[model samples]
Target: MIGIENIIFLIVAALGIGLFVWQIRKIRKNVLLGRDVELADNPSERINKTLLVAFGQQKMFKRMLPAVLHLFVYVGFIVINIEVLEILIDGIFGTHRVLGFVGPLYSGLMALNEILAALVIIACVMFLWRRNVTKVPRLATGVEMRAWPKVDANIILVVEIVLMLALFVFNIADMKRVLLAGEEVVGLYPVSQFFVDIFGEDPEQLYIIAKVGWWFHILGILAFMNYLPSSKHFHIIMAFPNVYYSKLLPKGKFTTNPAITHEIKAMLDPSYQPPAPEVDAEGNPVMQRFGAKDVEDLTWKQLMDSYTCTECGRCTSVCPANLTGKLLSPRKIIMDTRDRMEEKGEHPAIFAPNHYKELGVERVETTDEKTLLRGYITPEELWACTTCNACVESCPVNIDQVSTIMDLRRYLVLEESAAPASLNAMFTNIENNGAPWAFPASDRFNWADELYVPSKN
Candidate 1:
């Protein structure tokens, strides 16, 4: 016979799962709105990258103190979740300590979980101190880290502490129940043992405490799962796949647009033939825009990178232009992309829908118009980048902020012809003289003449 508790548990679990799945679907849809990119070249290398970078937290170790603290939290999140399996089973069947049948091994696992949970609480506290007390420069006071991003970071740390505390309370109360029943305690509750003394020897009272703690802890996990899709904390889930699909080419290497490459080749070789236009499913030639003017113009991986951003500001901290007081903040570039993506998802016609309609697209233009280029990020910020790859090297999640900046620059220069006067002059010089200087190709050796090698002899 099924009990009311089991039925209620099933309903709540079903609702949580359903909501989480829906959020995942929405995120997938938003990411797919971007242009298709092929990153399927190397399978083994991808797997190795995911393991080394994501699982190993290789990049994070560059900051040793934070890395150690983060390792504790990360390991605790994985190891302590083992108890959640037992919680699920117990919830569904209305059984107590079902895994306790594994005897000493079960007790050992419980002890390990308790120790890890305590460590997680401690780590979270240190993380908060690092953010608030230490005031790390890298975790800047910019608009990117202000508002909801700031609150979200603190909330996650507080939530972890709360969850870990609940686990200890549950274990302590459970131990009290064992004492009252005159049964030998099963698990080695080292940290929770102190709690047993506080709660005292009443089985009935302890049982109530245990149930409350258990319910809160399990429900907290479910709530945390659903919260992930909407928060920067989504990196907890996205990091694995993001690192797997990371750019395998050298960090300094920039991706060339195939369309522009083809055009240049055609110019260089008279015999070169242009490829046929890309056709949609209905066989109509699809017009592809060059570079990223909006979120939808970026590659899906770039969109994914935005969501995976931890907002740590490591990229912005290392950015040479930002250090030089330029407008560019690599962190903001990613945050802006995410903000624009979410804005468009919510408002739909936030971008110039009328423009899309005039081009014969299905989307209709609306009065509310915005774009990533000017609305969320400015051309000033875009052009400030030095293309130094410092941001890429500093990123813990392998987010290629430089690539995103380059794509926006490409859209501005190639599509809109919106380059600054100096850049325009440089482009003209490159076109005519085959150099960035205004001098003719004949003057290419002029700089070499300035350097005297007679001293070497």
Candidate 2:
């Protein structure tokens, strides 16, 4: 019972969905390349946080105007997708307005969709103006925003505008077609009704226009789905899980290295013995590094944070180090992490030998020997952080930018002994004098000696 058009639709849909799945799998593999860390505690709290931050857009309200506009676009994008389901059903079976059978309910849904589509168009236009004309500092500034990132934002906004317009054109033309046939229009077209007369009463012309608009809208959705992985808009899918797995501890609390803790314990108690080093599958002991020198050294959640970044620049805008004319930008740090991951991901032989062998390609050493530490992020940037957690608090998606900064600092201090000269002096004082001061512990109370009054019983 399938027509040629229905068969072609099936083929195109399969190709589009299959390509998206493949890219998603590749991204999943890249994220899992990092070391594992347990984040399975406090399930109920995690869910509530996810709902508030991701679904409720709680953090986005800090800026009122953009938040309101974003809400229109966000809600409209999601709610309008319900109509896509009906489109899919019609496309597969070669039926016309199949959901129109729902009678009054269908009319109500169509009316709502029309209004939302109009709102989305307006919101997207305003967003485009902000980016191009007004040049919002957070959205426009940043070395990362200069080239492709800038173009990508504009492209998405323009695409959204075109898609909404296509929806209106499709509705208006279809209404005209129904009227020409002397049949009652199935769905209400509040927004589209004004444009219904644009396409003359010619039956053939209305049918062609309607078909073009419908095809353009649906095809645009599929293309947009595939584009998400490569675009910053991937946050739409990654934000929920990223927020759920966010760090729950106090911002000032830093995670200490277990290897260092074990060493300290051994120094205090001679009877204490540290655990044995982990071995590989071949029984060779794995050499563990102290801190993250590369993406593989970071936790899986940290890598996920990289991909989940919305590039909204909220973190960078609030970064004290950046505001004070320092080389550090928290947004740049996260973007660098993602860039490194993508660089490594491109070379399958570097990560997966088995897969590379299956492809019948010769295993060759990569010419680029750059690492995430020196190549992507500089030492100056890592040391500039005040550890204020301003970036973490400002992030709409709960990305822990400070944690990554701390981990990089740990690598420099513990592994390379590369802490700045001032910090080295403090470390020596703490080791020898039990404090950050050069004086002995016995003289610590000397400052209060003048005002001291011993308790007399």
User: Each prediction's Cα lDDT score?
Assistant: 0.83, 0.86
Candidate 2 versus truth, CA RMSD in Å, comes to 5.9
Q: Tens digits of per-residue lDDT for model 2 on 1-457?
A: 5799898988888888898888888899989988879999999999999999999999999989889998988888888988998888888999888899999999999999999989999999999999999999989986556566787788899999999999998999999999989999998999988988998999999999999999999899998888888877889899999999999889889887787889899999999999987788999997777888998888999999988998899999989988887878899889878878877774221121212122332321112336778766778889889999999999989999998988888899989999999999999999999999799988988888669678999
| Predicted structure 2, TM vs. truth | 0.92
List runs of model 1 lying over 4 Å from the truth: 268-271, 346-369, 446-457
Question: Model 1: clashing residue pairs?
Answer: 353-365, 354-365
167-273, model 1: which lDDT tens digit per residue?
88889898888877889887677788876777767778888889889989989999988888767788998898888889999987888777787888999998999
Q: Name the lDDT value of residue 248 in candidate 1.
A: 99
